[model samples]
Target: MTAKVAGIPMILCALGVFVGGTIWTIVYSFTNSKLLPKTQWVGFEQYERLWGENRWLTSIENLAIYGACSLILSFVIGFVLAALMDQKIRFENTFRTVMLYPFALSFIVTGLVWQWILNPEFGVQSIVRALGWTGFTFDPLYNADIVIYGILIAGLWQGTGFIMVLMLAGLRGIDQEIWKASRVDGIPMWKTYLFIVIPMMRPVFITTLVIIASGIVRVFDLVVAQTSGGPGIASEVPAKYVYDKMFLSQNLGQGFAASTMMLITVAIVIIPWAYLEFGGKKRG
Candidate 1:
């Protein structure tokens, strides 16, 4: 009872800061708020303008591509690495450490490191050109057509290691009896992993999906640090758009509108999942 009483203030403060602030933003999004938030209501003008903007559209498209590719690739890479690690090979700890090292770095650091490595003048391109292949052009950051893919590479490098760790944990949690039973039944390793193991690990897969999906939506720092949404706004994400609109562009209404859309989009994804995962189970 005493601990519960002590926690009341903290809970109230969190509700005020997060829930209250979200309500404020949603209310202000309906107004024509500019540099300062005002009560001058403007209905859906901001949202209309947001959908009509090319940069926002580009950001949405880029996000879709990045999210899909990242989701598939990260799971594939992470699962593959985890499976290999599960083989009880020599130096397993050392290999696991090396695999997870990239995840230890912040997005900012990962972005900057990849930026330099991908730079045309002094990075991979130059090194390859110096090796008697001057015609080789691999500068994705400079190419607006493929800039998002470049960012995708950096994101995967920084993130897959963490996914691998999570997958390794999930793999470790599986009952050894299951593996032994499958082996005794003469079930091939791949078939057992595909048909039995994966089905059993649904909860872990869902958790990983949530984490990666959330990261995909909120990706901003890496973009800022790497390309600053540059190469002609090709790599601009929704989060970057929100920040630039609110602070840099001094259009609070526009930012709020974008943020509200993001919130709605997330809710659209999450609410259904929540219902299926929790609500349906409760009913069951």
Candidate 2:
């Protein structure tokens, strides 16, 4: 009884913090609140301005590119790595440990490390030039066009290991009899994986998709530590935009509106797929 009573307050406090905060933000989004929230309603003025800004639009575009490339590349690379590991090679545990070590570091650390490594003066480009490739130029952070791709590479390096581990676990869960039967039927390994194994791992894939999507949506610390939306907001992301508007720009209303749009964007991406994947089963 005592434990139950204690847990009730904890649950209520959590709900108050999360649910209450969300409601507060949403309510203030319609107002002209600046620095501090006020009850002066403005009825979509904040949203209109948010959508009108070029930086916000750029942020949205960057997120789309990053999210799409990250989703496809991470899954492909992770599955490929997982398949290789499933081959019963020597020193499998050592290889897995090495591969997954990057995921142990936080995004801030990963970003800082990659930032230094990708720096033109003292990093890869410099090393290559020192080795008689003076004509070579590989500076993504300085170039506005390809800056997001630089962030993508760093994100993939830090994230794919976790996805690979997940894929490997899914692979290991398959019955050995399935492999034997496929082999006996003279089915090629690739075909077997595509036609049989992958379909069986749908749940694992969906779980991984959700995790990666959430990470993509909330990616801010890495961008802050790495590029800081450099080269004139080229690598700007929605989360960073929200932070800047809320704190840096001192426009709480606009920030709230941007956050709401982000929530809407997530819902738009996730809802239909989720319905097709899980919701339709109830009707069936």
Candidate 3:
């Protein structure tokens, strides 16, 4: 009772900030507000423009590509690293620290680091050319065709380590008795992991998926620092579009509409899964 009493302020703040702020954003999203808040209502006019914009379309396509690739690669790379670390290899602590160091940096820093690394003149391309290969070309940020992948590279480098840590924790939580039983049953190590351990780590994997999915949906900082939605808006994501519209372009209505769409998209993806995750557990 005392704990609940002490939580009153926090509860009020959540209601005032998150719920209230969300309602305000959604309300204004339907208005013809620009630069400053106006009483004029737009009635989905901003949404029409949002859907018709080529740049917004590009952003969605790029987001889809980034999200899919990031999910697959993050899981695979993180699990592989975790599995290797689980072997109790030599210099385990040192290797883990080295791998996780990137995750400590902010997305902005990661983007800038990758920006320099992907620079055609002074980065990987230049180094390879300097090594007697005069015709080397590998600059994803400069090429509109694969700029999103460039940002994805930075995203993966910065994020995969954290995923590895989470997976490692999950792996460490497995019962040693399971390993003993598998060994007695003459089960192959790979088969045991694939069929037994992974299945048992379902909760951890679901949590990791949620984290990765949310990050993919709201990806903005890396794109800003690395490519700034270029070369030619090739790396734009939904969050960036919302920010540009609201702050840069002073199109508050449009920005609000975009943000609302993002919210809906997230809810669409999350609500059903969450119902199954928590609701089914409660029922059982």
Model 2 Cα lDDT, one tens digit per residue, 1-284 = 99999899889998999889888889999999998999999999999998899999999999999999999999999999999999999999999999999999999999999999999999899999999989999999889999999999899999999999999999999999999999999999999999999999988998888889988998997899889998889999999999999999999999999999888777876886698688878888
| Global lDDT of model 3 | 0.93
For all predictions, the C-alpha RMSD in Å is: 1.3, 1.9, 1.1
For model 1, the stretches where C-alpha displacement exceeds 4 angstroms are none
> Could you give the candidate ranking by TM-score, starting with the highest?
3, 1, 2
Clashes of each: 0, 0, 0
lDDT of each: 0.93, 0.94, 0.93
TM-score, per-candidate, Cα-based: 0.96, 0.94, 0.97
| Residue pairs in clash, model 1 | none
Best prediction by TM-score: 3
Candidate 2 regions with alpha-carbon error over 4 angstroms: 1-7, 269-284
Per-residue lDDT of candidate 3, residues 186-251 (tens digit): 999999999999999998998898889889999999999998998877888899999999999998
Tens-place lDDT digits, model 1, residues 177-212: 999999999999999999998888887888898889
